[model samples]
Target: TFLDAVSRARPEIGDYPFTTIHPNVGVVQTKDGRSFILADLPGLIEGASTGKGLGHQFLKHIERCRVILHVIDMGSSEGRDPLEDYEIINNELKDYQMRLLERPQIVVANKMDLDNAKENLERFKKKYPDVEVFETTTIIHEGLDPVLRKAADLLATTPTFPIMDDEGTESSVLYTFEEKRPEIEVTQVEDHVWQVTGTKIERVFNINKLNTEEDFYLFADRMRYMGIDAALREAGCMDGDTVQLCGFEFEFIEN
Candidate 1:
């Protein structure tokens, strides 16, 4: 219904740009003539914490939002329980980051025109007694005025939150260092052949795309700095041994 809102706000606009690659941003003008930047972020789903269905990318954007307008399908036209849907989405949000639950949220119980929508809404109200819900049916644009007004009012008082990695903020420095864990693994596949595996090593290997001799030397230098060279020697790897790392096999030359 974001597209509907946009079209009504600006009649000249023909269509909403729909894509998952990036967010759709538009200026939403309120009845009081105050405009707010409304971003239509990609829909999140269950298991978003472990990189499921847009994952951290979607949740990361939500961190910047001061007020979260949770649009729920009250009709449950897709056969899923509306309450369960709400819980699932909220759980995903909470699981991804506890701070997300702290955002001031206004639930928009949408599709009120559909059958059993009212009944489902009643159930939803009972489930979440304290949650503020705005009833709406975007098809007829009913109840949207109040929702937008409430959102704008809330936004007026709400402060903009910094993104997750806002290094300039004082809160970023409040960190506790823990014992570092082993990030790379070295194993002997054969007498003169060794295999190296780890997220950090593999990521560096893939990102560097060691296609040229210079690139390979740079990668080797990084590995040495990371102590992977010492690790290979400690693991019983000898000079001229074949070391397999991230699918790339190279001869080890001890210095």
Candidate 2:
């Protein structure tokens, strides 16, 4: 409902949990003619960072987000402690490999119209003294404008985080003299263990969400067309040699 107030992306609003099965991306325009993309990702339950509940799915959607609008149910409508909910989410983010906690965060004290909401908000404010909290009741569209404005303000100043991986992000850049460098690179991580990595490959892996044999074959076809197989051979890879791509390992084959 909050997203509906800011943008037209009226995702499934309900009283029960997990109304959003997939993410809904919407463009938000503030009053000052400024705009930004807002992604209404699925709710994160406990153990989300560990691939439990819609864990990785919800977390992955926020990778490109510059600011996180954390909405808390101040009324404890679901019988949860609002302050404890914040800590639980923060712990999940910290546990995730992406360092999600490092992003700029704005807290939204939602359900302000409900009883005990004001009391919960007071406790939250005291606990998170340095954090910015916005009082709001998303159902009626109250106090949502400030969130949009603040999000836009933060986006205008924050820089894009550097993309990297422990597996050969350095070798991904060959430092060639040509104007167009290779979009990908192959690195030998260890004996008979080759790693295919680059900015493009990582982005592709994140976007594709390959989960079946057909998807795997399609990705393999793409690698072949992109000369990844040839690069592996050039790097002294042989049949049955291990090739790692985005942490997944496979055996090289010579045809």
Return the lDDT, model 1, position 194. Answer: 77
Error (Å) of candidate 1 at residue 48 is: 0.5
lDDT of each candidate versus the true structure? 0.70, 0.72
Q: Could you tally the backbone clashes for each prediction?
A: 0, 0
Tell me the alpha-carbon RMSD of every candidate. 15.3, 15.0
lDDT of 1 by residue, 1-255 (tens): 554564343212111110011345567777777777776665555566665423665677788788888888899765558898789888988887737888788899989999999999999889789988999988887888787788889899987665664444474454768565447989897677677777677667556643344555576678888888899889998876766664334567765
Q: Estimate each model's TM-score.
A: 0.59, 0.61
Best by lDDT: 2
lDDT string, candidate 2, 1-255, tens digits: 567778887554322110122466789998889999988665565576876523676677677777888889999875669998799888888887675777899899999999999999888888889988999988888898898899999999987754433644354555647465356888897677677767676567567645444555666676677777888889899876766665344567766
Q: How close to the true structure is residue 4 of candidate 1, measured as C-alpha lDDT?
A: 55
Supply candidate 1's per-residue lDDT for 107: 95
Deviation from native of the Cα of residue 191 in model 2, angstroms: 54
